[model samples]
Target: MARWHRVFRRWVLARHYRFAREALVPHFFDALTAYALELSRLGVPHAKEAVAALRELRTLPLPSFTGEVEDVFFSIEAQLLEHWGEEVAGALRRGLSRNDLDLTVFRAYLKDRALLLLGDLLRLRKALLARARAHFGVPLVLSTHHRPAQPTTLDHYLLGVEALLARDTERLFRALSGMDRSPLGASALAGNPYPVDRRRLAHLLGFAGPVEHTLDAVASGDYALELAAALALLGTSLTRLATDLLRWAEAGAFLVGESLAQGSSFMPQKRNPVVLEHARIYAARLLGGVGTLLALNHNTPFTDLNDHSTGVLEPLSELLEAGEGALELLWVALEESQFVEERLLSELSPEVMASEAVDLLVRKGLPLREAYARVKAALPGVRPETLGVEREELLHWMGLEGFFARREVLGGAGPRARAEALSEAERRLKEDQKRLGALRARVRAARFLLARGLEDPQAEEGQEGEVG
Candidate 1:
């Protein structure tokens, strides 16, 4: 082999194999065990010894194999052939191909990582919820188009962020659901001839069920794409939040804890919110990875191409790992940072409450356009005399608390509306928590069954389990 070819085999291929070793190899062996037991049940030759040999293989340390082929599956088979001989290796390879096995392992690996990402996301959500509750009714100026538009409570802004993340949570769950099916029995993009029970294989591997179409099982990379896209969407939301926090930190309306902030080397007064900056970088990497994955899948044949399978795994895994880091940093920033309430109130433009002033004139029978025009005519200062209202009433309308008080309509910033919104947010948070908990429980149970099956290949036969 050429030097670069040898290097590729030694580094790139070896790295991928190591990842497989850590994340999916055990699951692959579990599937093989299940297959052997199924073949034994069907009285296939060599099936009985295959199971014992696989049990022995699992007990030994996985050997490192960097054969000239540059394929991890081939390397594994080579090891099996060398260690367990032809009869056992051939028996396990019966009706199996690298195409199906690789895809199955990829799916299993993605599912496991997705669960971990989901856990990180849930923690971030919980932290944001708690922060929202803590800052309830604390006033701040809401901005649009980079300018102050109105007054809103800190909790209201945080809740809006939570709502966006809530949608991301649903998308993640949908992606996980898309990946729930096992592709184990689809041998080389075609249905296997052996009487192997596909559903049993899925059960032993913590999958919800088997993919129905054999070709689709191996050919479809849409599940990985869906997950990447969901992570990208989540990255967008986090980027926006990070941007907002950066702005707030710059304005001194939010304080990054001293431990989280980085001081300038030369500038005496500079304290950079590097935590948010790093979080944004991680989010950008996620978005970039999504584009790379999409481009890799583009223009490729849809039938079990390496471009869509092994090719996307590294980038996808990096995206998930980056997302986890981003979520953790953001959660820490949210929990540890403090809002400068006095600075927030002091920095608000007095005219931020002008919308309430507009509403006041409309309530007195002025047309909406006329009320808006009258408020616009007041320039930067809306004095009581200029607006033809008593000073006391005008002051009340222009005050932040009064501004929030009068907007009692549904979804408004008024106390009643804010209270209702908080209650609804709390309800949604609790429901999401419950749903995540249930999903985690299902995964745990399925993993338990899979481990037990590995321990004794026949132990989980005829047992029922489901995971998604």
Candidate 2:
């Protein structure tokens, strides 16, 4: 087997295999081999004896075992019973079903994927920060109505992107919080017959708690729903960003320094904003995947196949892979394109700062609306109502003493808010790093046990459970 397969096999041998085997002790069920690896993890005392007995069925000198029913999960547990010296066949009998088991597996899988996505988030933040730092004071154009309105720092322009991504990170964490429950005891629809510890199963699966009730456990799929929604929002934000990049990086705008060129079969010169184009298309693709998932499970039974604790496993897998890849690639592109703002300045004239001018006039004692009209009339064109002032003078006037300070109030792009935002982002990075480190340790320990080829089926042990 490949190294990763072996490692995965080892994890299956330890935790997952043990749980499933314990869940199905009797070799009676046919589709149980799906959980055989977990059987090995259960560490039942009668395991070897059970294995011996099952082997006899296979090796019987009779035509008894006719149906080639899959039972590796239960059969392995039976085989290893002697080695464990104890058995939970009684408890396992009453409290679980394939439905709950599959949901529980999905929870575990999403937890792992969430951690992986955190890594992508880190790189994304880093990309934005690098751009901000490199172009901290580079002048660029600001726009509204598809027309340039005023000038601003190039790095200041990227601040909007940083703010959006920061919001996405917040949304991601909020969505993840919704998936913290376990549904192990919610067998099929009602629940298992036994008083098997549902909460304990949750603890075993690294969940925050049991999912309240049986039906809710089996039927609840809000995690997938909310995650898809959040992802859609994120995709939309990405598309907006892509839109800005594509529009502002035009040959005419010349606000982005890039040699995005390649020869086409028929054309002599085919320089294009390929990076921004890819980002735009991929953002659409991301949104589409989320939409597809929603449609796939809309009419399914409460605990139906299509839901699979989500719209469908296949689409989610695609979302995770494609979204992360596109974001990562964008990070590289973000770091490359230097912000070229001279053309941007030409487009976004001194009047885009008209709001600041209005604020200035308002402070000078004019009514807000009157100040706005006064500044509007004094500033620019027939479309904007132009004033013939020198651009350099207006630029300085825009950043005049009171203007910068007054605008910095709270969440505004004032110096203080920018600093506070940066600090908050840094603090979150540290907290997430600590959490990520713990998750890696858990995954790595799992790998370590598998590599040794020496694991006894057992419940999960880590900081995740209330009980070890």
Candidate 3:
């Protein structure tokens, strides 16, 4: 029941407590306090044991529990490091400063969080791929400027989203691997003479090795910032996809699949694309995190600036939350959302067949521009076969024959690439699944920023070994 000021003064701030309260407290502050004890353990072999024997009941920083825990810490120090209460307290002038410790801990924590975020992103990719598979050949009309523009399959569209996500998943892994080195050995920007085994600490923390440069280790939150940027980008892409679906489905013409909507409070006929709308808002907010982090580093040293840390919570929180729910939600939406053959068939105007018409004119010995002009005269808004070409052979010769056939180029909207992309997406989804699990393990070791609904994206079908 002690006031914060009294607790701060008695246990934490009687002396040498020259730090901001805000910086001193976070979810991981207790971890840092335990880490300090671990350091004390190095100098005093039975220090931790003695403290435990004192019935402290915990080994973490707790001003609230200071009556028990701090007394134990004192007892252990007196019995082991100190001369049995003769030298109860003293400050060391050499070795690592708390600043260095902060740098090291956060570097470790950020690496873990990045891995977790990566895993969530991977789940999203799998969900998208599964949706893609179920809808590839299912026909739908592609819209440009919110109007039906061309014939496209659901799979082709999802493939574009999948490709972007695949790249994002790769970026996350690269960030994690590159940033997974331990910074503990860097102590105070110069190596300590106490012979502390940095690599041993790295091993304890599951890092590949100690960071190479002490100064660099102290200064680089760039890895986390890069990860933030990447996550934001990935979120933006997912949001974009979601935003499109919300718009398309709301239009009512693309009602090939059942609507993932709800009635409004005031109106009965109001089926809102609420999730997509939220995603759109969150995507922008996630993008803002990147900007804020960048600006935080702009005025300060590029190394682990506190400003960089402070500005991240808003964007990162939004991104994680959005990914957790929006991903699974959209996957379900994509799965149920059917491709309207009528909407697609309606797009079959001869003007959509214009490209083929020009080709027909060219084959007929007309100049390319003349052919274009002739076709231009034919279309303001019309689908393929709606053009003047009555003969299928003429249209076939012109290459507007089949929507799928005309798109057989190397990376065009060909069924093969669409199928291939979906397969690749599925394959990558598995990689993501494995990667997601791995990343989640890493993050759980660091913090509690785990998101929701990341699991079960494609659980209805056995997608474990089946994406690519």
In terms of lDDT, the best-performing candidate is 1
lDDT per residue for candidate 3 within 74-144, as digits (tens), equals: 32333333332322123221254444555555555556456556655666666666766766676665667
Error of 2 at 295 (Å): 3.5
Better of 2 and 3 by TM-score: 3
- Each candidate structure's TM-score, on Cα atoms with residue i matched to residue i, is 0.91, 0.70, 0.72
Tens-digit lDDT string for candidate 1 (1-468): 343466776677777777776666776766677677666666676776777776667666665644454555566567678877887677778888777788888887788888888888888878877887888888887689988887788888887888899899999999998888888888888788786778877766667788989998888788888999999999999999999999989889889988899999999899899999999999878888768878888887877464347678888988999999899999999888999987776647647777888888888888999889888888687766777888798777678777777789887777788778778877887887787777667657656654444433543455332211
- Reference-based TM-score, model 2: 0.70
Scored against the true structure, residue 411 in model 1 reaches a CA lDDT of 73
Per-model CA lDDT versus the true structure: 0.79, 0.56, 0.54
Model 1 misses residue 256 by how many Å?
Answer: 1.2
- In model 2, where do residues sit more than 4 Å from their true spots? 1-96, 251-263, 303-311, 341-344, 355-371, 378-396, 399-406, 440-468
List where candidate 1 sits over 4 angstroms from the true fold: 1-12, 68-70, 306-308, 452-468
Better of 1 and 2 by TM-score: 1
Q: Candidate 3 at residue 349, lDDT?
A: 57
